[model samples]
Target: MLEPAEASPGTQAEQASFQGIRRICGFIAENFREDIDCVDIAVSADIHPKYAMSVFKRSTGMSLGEYVSLMRVSYAQALLMRDDASILQVAMDSGFGSVSAFNKCFRKKAGMTPSEFKREHRAAPPPLHA
Candidate 1:
């Protein structure tokens, strides 16, 4: 499946514009672990903060904070599903500053607490075939 920009446009300007946003998105994905703000992200993306926020929101349909939280919650959810990493480990590794924040976001996004998610989603051992 193609992204909207990839599927709908082939113009050079469109491609360039898309690339700029992609660069920003990539930076966010890579560095959301650290404390990152819109200004820092904008600097990494080589654009002004206000413009970056506007562009990002327009392109992605969410504010930068929302996107970062979404990304963190998503990564944390994946770790939780594995059921090996501790909740605190998942929180830190997934870029949350604290367990409380991670839990709040996880519940908002997944409709369950992190521990509950892990417990419920943990895969059962394969049936022991004789």
Candidate 2:
């Protein structure tokens, strides 16, 4: 499904705030692999964390933490598509601090564990090569 970059705002001020949140989103998407927090996102957008919390929620229909989790999980999904790596490797590549964290987030967002997701989504592996 196509997700929108931003939601419609009710006023000029809200629109401006949401635009700032969009910038935060872009920054997160670009630097998600690095350790990031709401403060960093807020700073990147020239806002305070307290205010960013509200604006990001209003603009994205999700909290900043939720957005970060979603991005990490999404990246993990991409990594899981490949069969060349272990779960720990995928978790690390996807910016999760631990395999347990990756599994928990994957299960929460995908309604299944990472292994289950990979098994269900990945096609059958080719026959063993000689």
Candidate 3:
């Protein structure tokens, strides 16, 4: 998975714009641990929320809200992989205010509850010391 910073450069202006958008996306992904909304992403991207949503959707083929949700769910998937956190905690930490909302969105986007996701991708324990 290439971090936004890892994207290749292009023509000067194109590269600058691409880097700008990548920085905005990276900021959102990083701050996703906090309460992030379309307005926040818009401000980060230096555009009106409506315009940001439009351009972001056109560029990514998903609405800004949907993209944020996917990013949140993706982060939750990582936490679930550890098998050390509760689903509710994962929801809260991933920016979901309520478990029901989290479950609904998770099922809609991921086709499974957080618990099911965790079970499916549970990491193996470390080998015991001899």
Candidate 4:
């Protein structure tokens, strides 16, 4: 996935802002599977916590929390494609704090519950053990 970067070459201040955004995005990509917040993201980008959300939102057109939720939901979607794990397991593995939270976010982003998505789109189920 492309980390948020400068849209076009411009002023030095714009260049520096894009660099900070890149660092923030890189940190998010690496740690989206872990619990993280604006403070952590700001620290990763060496920016102020209060400024992180506004900067990220301005560049990416989305809030940090929204970005994190989308990342988690995207990971859960990939996991749901396999039959080896249940929805709850996938939710936890995707870094959601609880099944309900996972379901809510997944529904918002995916337009369906995890179980429904799995049923509709999962690959062939694994062989059953004797």
Candidate 5:
């Protein structure tokens, strides 16, 4: 019979860290449409806020706020494509407090303002039947 190799201490630590990161990500995904902060994320993941910030940064190379902003902007992009909603409405729906913030973050990550992105990427309408 083949014996299973025991995990080393480093591997075990890495596993724990991975689990923590997963929990943090889950919380963020579930609540990204709300006004969530590091303290909220930490509480959901059962870690100290400061520790959560460090772990998130170490694993994702960005702060919690940055991740949240990314999620919001990405969502806003989809909304802009499919909805005729105004930019302010899309920003609010995507969890941004204001259109300026939405435009700034969207431009930072997507290389264009929300309006520009919508103009460039909105889907064309289907042809009418004869």
Candidate 6:
């Protein structure tokens, strides 16, 4: 069950806190392709890093670093789907400092190396029937 905003001070504070979390998450999603950090996100949300981290963890059940890693891996997945990008380029574009680190993380998250993932996805057959 959920309480209405007008029901109590606690409810109102909860609502405001939820909104703040959403703003922070949205900012991260939008800028995840860039080199970003907890401080950057906290500044964008007009909150302190420690407070932002606490709020984000409460709402997302993950730390800001975990969220960023997931976002970066997701972006890499999208880039890997494209034929125009090399794995190294995708790594750099997704804000990883080095290809080895990117490959390690990609393997951890996607269960394969970036090159293998890209090749498998790129080689998939399209549906024949409409």
In lDDT terms, which candidate is top? 4
Model 4 clash count equals 0
* lDDT string, candidate 1, 91-122, tens digits: 99989889999889889988999999899888
The number of residue pairs in model 3 that clash at the backbone is 0
- The better-scoring model by lDDT among 1 and 6 is 6
Give the top-scoring candidate (TM-score).
5
The full ranking of all candidates by lDDT, starting with the best, is 4, 5, 6, 1, 2, 3
CA lDDT scores, all candidates in order: 0.85, 0.84, 0.81, 0.89, 0.89, 0.87
Which 10 successive residues of model 3 have the least lDDT summed?
7-16
Clashes of each: 0, 0, 0, 0, 0, 0
| Residue pairs of candidate 4 with colliding backbone atoms | none
**Cα lDDT of model 3 by residue, 30-127, tens digit:** 88778888888878877678877766676788887788788899998988898678998999999998999899999999999888889989998899
lDDT of 5: 0.89
The true-versus-predicted C-alpha distance at residue 83 of model 5, in Å, is 4.2
lDDT of 4 by residue, 39-118 (tens): 99999999998788988899999999999899899999999998787988999999999999999999999999999999
What TM-score, over all chains together, does every model reach?
Answer: 0.83, 0.83, 0.78, 0.86, 0.89, 0.84
Model 2, 38-107: lDDT tens per residue?
9999999998899999888877799988899899989888888887757888898887888898889889
Candidate 6 residue lDDT tens string, 27-103: 99898878889999999888899989998898889999889888899999988998788988999999788999899
Model 5 regions lying over 4 Å from their true place: 1-5, 128-130
RMSD of 5: 2.5
The worst-scoring run of ten residues by lDDT in candidate 5 lies at: 1-10
Candidate 5 per-residue lDDT, tens place, 45-123, comes to: 8889999999889999999999999999889999999757689989999999888888899999999999999898888
RMSD of 6: 3.0
Q: Model 6: runs farther than 4 Å from truth?
A: 1-5, 123-130
Ten contiguous residues with the weakest lDDT in model 2: 1-10
Position 15, candidate 5: lDDT: 74
